[model samples]
Target: MPRRVFVHIGAPKTGSTYVQNVLFDNAERLEKAGILIPATFAAHDQAMTDLREVPWRDPEAYWTWDLLAEKAAAFRGDVILTSEGFGAASAEQAKRAVESLQPAEVHVVVAARDLWRTFPSMWQQSIRARGTWRFEDFLAAVEKGEFEGFWEHYTANRMFLRWGDLVPPAQRHLVTVPPPGVSHDLLWQRFAGVFGIPDGLCEMTEPTANPSLGAPEIELLRRVNAALGDRYPHRMPYQRVVQQHLVKAVLQKRANNVRFGVGLDRADWVMALAEEQINQLRAYDCHIVGDLDELRPAVMTDSHSPGELADRQLLDAAVETIVGMIGHADELRQMIPPGHSGVLARVRRGIRRRLG
Candidate 1:
């Protein structure tokens, strides 16, 4: 039989990071199992180039798609292409993606979560990306259809309809996130089943994943971005300090043990929208794993209002950011050349001697 290609298209914020980390970490085992996830992390970049609708540029952007397809055609094992961004590709772009991986039996896998559960996290992600809108205003923008990416990327009903336009319903697989209170690893099990891997076949490579932020923590980041407006307009520094250090390193540590959810007003509309999406998904002749009922948004009782953050809460978040930035500076200090910093070298030697 010819090699099979499984395209794990994403509707992000649905454990895509966890799944990618597993696949990339256990690449050797996967190769032994006759499956190959491309070595480079530019699958989506290549797809965007192929789609040509988005003005994306990378040094290798022009040839990534053809190169991947060529590699798949030459390899004996199955090829797996995964990127949550691909889940938002238009019908034409998806067609190009499918064609590029021709000669192999192509299957698309989509991992999704309940709309209500997804939005709060999505809103937090936007904040991490330097968005200044509060959760309420974000919801208002979504309902008004103001943000192009809101419905296009986060809404399952729209994403599936676009990707499924070309791929047969049978070839489209929907993996619904199990409702909370169940095993957190269940989603991985559902994902691994696509490639016939047994449960626990792959282990989580990182100790912690891309954790979510509490409302106050996210609001703090937004305020910081607003304060730094135009001063750090470049995407690189913002992504580095705010996204990498502030959000991931600092805020995630402080934000842990805190949970936030969609508010009551947002809940009703989100739940109704989730139900409509679930109904539409059911109508498709796709292979669905996990309980469809899991798509129903559970009653979220502990919602936090960004507007209601106490002065102390904001101050606490700011203090944590300062401490985290200090720690990050220490890490950077360690990375400096020993010849460049005699003080750091002596400090390192003292620490090493103490450990010894």
Candidate 2:
């Protein structure tokens, strides 16, 4: 039989990191089980790039369909590819991606979360990636549809709908992220089900804690990125390493930190819009794998109170993220051998030296 290819096209912020990390960390084990996750440093980047129409200069723009095709062709078993940013691609880009995979039975799996939560997380992510806008202002821009022009720019539900536009209804599998109270394993179960993997075979691994910016942290990020914006735009990976890992880590570890999420009023507004979109998606006859009620937004409660932390705590968290990312840094440095050890690697090494 021709290899059945499963493509998890992320709508972003739905445990994509955990999923990708698991696949990358266990590629050999998975391959032995007849599932193949192509080995590529850029698998996540390329999958997202193939779906979106972004500026070529963007770091994520490095993802290319031609490369993905080459990787797909080499797979010996059922192929699985994933990237959340792929939700942003234009119809044309989506068509090209499907065409590239030609002849293979392509199954597109999308994991979506409620907008009330997703919007804020997405905003923080942008800020971590070098965006300078205030949370309130960022929400306003998204409300005004200011970011609609770029492929993969933030649109609550618009991008979610695009998966349907790109692939046939029969081929699309829409997986809803269960609310916070549900076990995290719920997501993995649904994903495995779609791929025809037996339940309980793949262990539910701990996902990396991608700390969301509480209001205070968001404000701090805005200030830091504003100071750094002229020096580095969001398109640069080096900038992401600095802003996301180094700076944000310091702010989050501060004592009396607030948890990240929208204020009640704003969360309500975004959730209302999300509900409208969810209803629209249901109308389209999409194959939803989880309960829609579980997708509804609830009141935002502070997981932590605003407080100060000892400087040591702040430094520790930042150091951890930096250390974790060093492998990526090494890979990056190897690519640009002539480039200086760059700010990210330097900062990581600096943290380790300080900690030691």
Candidate 3:
């Protein structure tokens, strides 16, 4: 039988970090189980960096696919490659991706969630990626679907759709990650199944939390961006240091009171949109594994006391900022080429040191 090749192209905000960490950590074990997660260098971190730097433009843009084929060709075990950013590929990119990987029985696994939850998480992700837009304004754009341009560029959903347009429906698998009620293990099991991993070969041992922004926290972020917009574009590394490290860290430390609740009106709008999306997806005969109803929004309830909500919100934001910093640490570290001038190295080192 031909070796199977699985591509877990993430539609982000779906516990992708945790999944990537697991695969990276257990590469040997999976290889023993006839599964291969390829890395050009012995360093696991290098694989991630390569994925990040893979070009998506021009004649040489199919380099990632070439890299994939080269990696897969060398591995005897089933091959698996993953990157959430792959979900944002343009149509031309998608076509090239498919053509480059031809002859491999490519199975694309996309983890999806209800838009109601995904929307807010995506907004937080945008903020982390240096996006400067108010939650209300973002929602307004989403409602108008004027966001199709931005969505086409940044969202995994659009990429998934485009990929589906290029590939046979049976070749794609849509894994719906149920909301908080379901066991996280169960969700992982479904994912593993799609990748053809045998039962018990993988275990969920990591407690990676990719928390989303509560309404109050998002509102605070909006205000911070608005206040700092002229002084610092959100994308600037300096602003990232201040906002994510200093400001967010202080707030996260004092979880006294910072609760956020969506008003009934917004909740309703979110639910309606989610339902519409779910209906549309069903038309594609996509393989949905969980209950779509789990996506329904609930009335806002305060988990923390009113007195504590403010502090807690600040604390959450701070933690989120710290997490963001950690996520970027490796990339920053690799950017400094070895044997550079001492002064240049010092400057790079100082910037990286500040990240912690």
Candidate 4:
């Protein structure tokens, strides 16, 4: 049989990072078991230049789709294209993605979570991307249908149709995140089943999840985004610092155990909306793994709101976050090799010679 392909088109924050972590951690073993993670998730971004409707100065991007295809085609076994972003592609873009990986039976796997729970996390993600919207405003944007990406990602009813538009219902699989308190690794097991991987196969790579921020921690980051407005016009520098360093290295460490969730007022609407979405998900003819009812989130009460937090809460978070940045900066500087320090290298050398 031709190589089979399993693509985890994400509705992000639904264990996408964990899934990729497991697959990548056990890449060699998975490959030996006749499965190929064709490329890193970021590498696939190059393959979507056309789908993004963006211009590419890098010639390599022009052929990245083909190159991804070539890697898949050369592999003798199944291929896995894992990216949460893939879950956001429009129907036409998804069709293009499907076409590029032709001559193989391509299956799509979507991991979905409770809609009400996803929003706060999604807002945290937006803040990481330099959004200055307060928590309440973010929710307003979603309800008003103003937040395009949020609508596309959080609505399983909409994304399923778009991603499964061309693929058959049977091959379009849904993995519902089991509600809290169940086996944590159950999500991976559900995913492994859909991807045709044996459970506990190849030592079953360590379970991992992305770092998350508490409400106050995320609020602090949102304010920081507002303060840094227009400073780094380029995406890379900001992404390198705020996203890669500040968020990951600093803010994430400042998280209090206090979980963030929708307020009672927002919960009323979000729960209602999640119910509507769940009903719509029932309408899809796709195969379902795990309980679909798990998508219905209970109204959350014990939660912190970014807008409603006390000044003290935010001040405490900010102070620690600042300290974390300093410590992290020092830690990073320690990791740098001595000779790699440019002109500082000459200064240190002269000091050492005088001491000698």
42-147, model 1: which lDDT tens digit per residue? 5644654555454433434444666667766777878787877777777777788788776678888887788777888888877776778888788787788788
Candidate 2 residue-wise lDDT, 1-356, digit = tens = 22777777777788777777766776777777888777664755755654565553465355466777777877766888787766667767767776777578877787777777776678777777677766666666767868654225343255545555656777778788888877777777788788777665565578776566555555555655678655665465644666555554454544424455565656566677778767876776557788766567754653322123345644554455456466555755687656664866888999999999
lDDT (tens digit, per residue) of candidate 3 on 1-356 = 22667777677777767767767777788889888887632232333334444432222223345665677777766888787766666667666666655576766777776665566677766765556676656777877877885566443356567776666778778777766666677777777877777887775566564344454555555556556665654234534575556445443333324443333556667677667756666667555556556545433332321123466755666576556556556656677678664767688799999996
Best TM-score among the predictions, by candidate number: 4
lDDT score of residue 182 within candidate 1: 72
TM-score of each: 0.85, 0.76, 0.71, 0.87
Candidate 4: residue pairs that collide: none
- The local distance difference test score of each candidate is 0.74, 0.65, 0.61, 0.76
Error of 2 at 60 (Å): 12
After best superposition, candidate 3 residue 296: deviation in angstroms? 4.3
Tens digit of per-residue lDDT, candidate 4, span 5-92: 8878787788778778788878888888999987676666666554545442234444366677778888888988776767777788
lDDT of model 2, residue 303? 33
Task: Give the higher-TM-score candidate: 2 or 3.
Answer: 2
Given candidate 2, what's the lDDT at residue 57? 44
Candidate 3 segments exceeding 4 Å error = 40-65, 149-157, 213-244, 247-257, 295-356
